[model samples]
Target: MNAPARLRMSRTALLPVLILVFCVVPLALASAWTLVLLLIPVAVAAWVLRVGVDIGDDGITARSLAGSRTVSWTELAGIRIDERNALWLVTTAGTEVRLPVVRTRDLPRLAALSGGRVDVPAPPAQ
Candidate 1:
């Protein structure tokens, strides 16, 4: 069996996090108050870096700023894409779990990871 596919924020999404951390370093060194402000960039980086989705044969695991949750294939009722292009996993209990950083382009990978549990929508006729 193939290993799980891990999806994370694209490098473009991470650029702002890196820039903020670098920009804050100077200010953080200058003042005590600024030092406290340093936490902002650190938190942003952590949030951006930690948020991801892991799809394996067993289930889908989503990690966010709050925490991580894994839903088995049997637990998922369906998957849908929102107007914003975010992927949402609808649970058997009717709960929606939003997958951060999951774009439309990632649907194929997600479908494959789920072993056909999730359906990948067909592309619109061009």
Candidate 2:
């Protein structure tokens, strides 16, 4: 079996920092309201970071506490890099799925692995 290519969860870097700055720092500064108000962003960040991705010879897989999905390299048509710098895998069905944080920088790498190109498409008109 081909060895699995491990990718660390993206939230591992950002969540702690946000928690420290917004939650811990505010509490340290003795601001109750700040801590309370920051909770929303903190929760959202936590939720966002919880998603992770892994790649290997079989293809690419995204795992989260919520669920897991494996996408074959062939099934992945291409990648779209958003203005926000988010990388999404384009499926043959024309649906776009956001890659996990760990796979953010992995776009170019994935493109290289799939022998494809990385192109950021223009956003649709508002």
Candidate-wise lDDT, in order: 0.85, 0.64
> Ten-residue segment with the worst summed lDDT in candidate 2?
113-122
Q: Write the per-residue lDDT of candidate 2 for residues 75-107, one digit (tens) a residue.
A: 888776788876777788887767666435555
Give one digit per residue, the lDDT tens place, for model 1 in 1-126.
Answer: 568788987757668877888888998999787799788977887887789999887789989988998888889998878899888889999998999889888888878777788888777999
Q: List candidate 2 segments past 4 Å from native.
A: 10-50, 102-105, 111-126
Best by lDDT: 1
The predictions' CA RMSDs to the true structure, in order, are 2.3, 6.8
- Error of model 2, residue 88, in angstroms: 0.7
**TM-score for each candidate, following the candidate numbering:** 0.83, 0.54
Off by over 4 Å in 1: 1-3, 11-14, 123-126
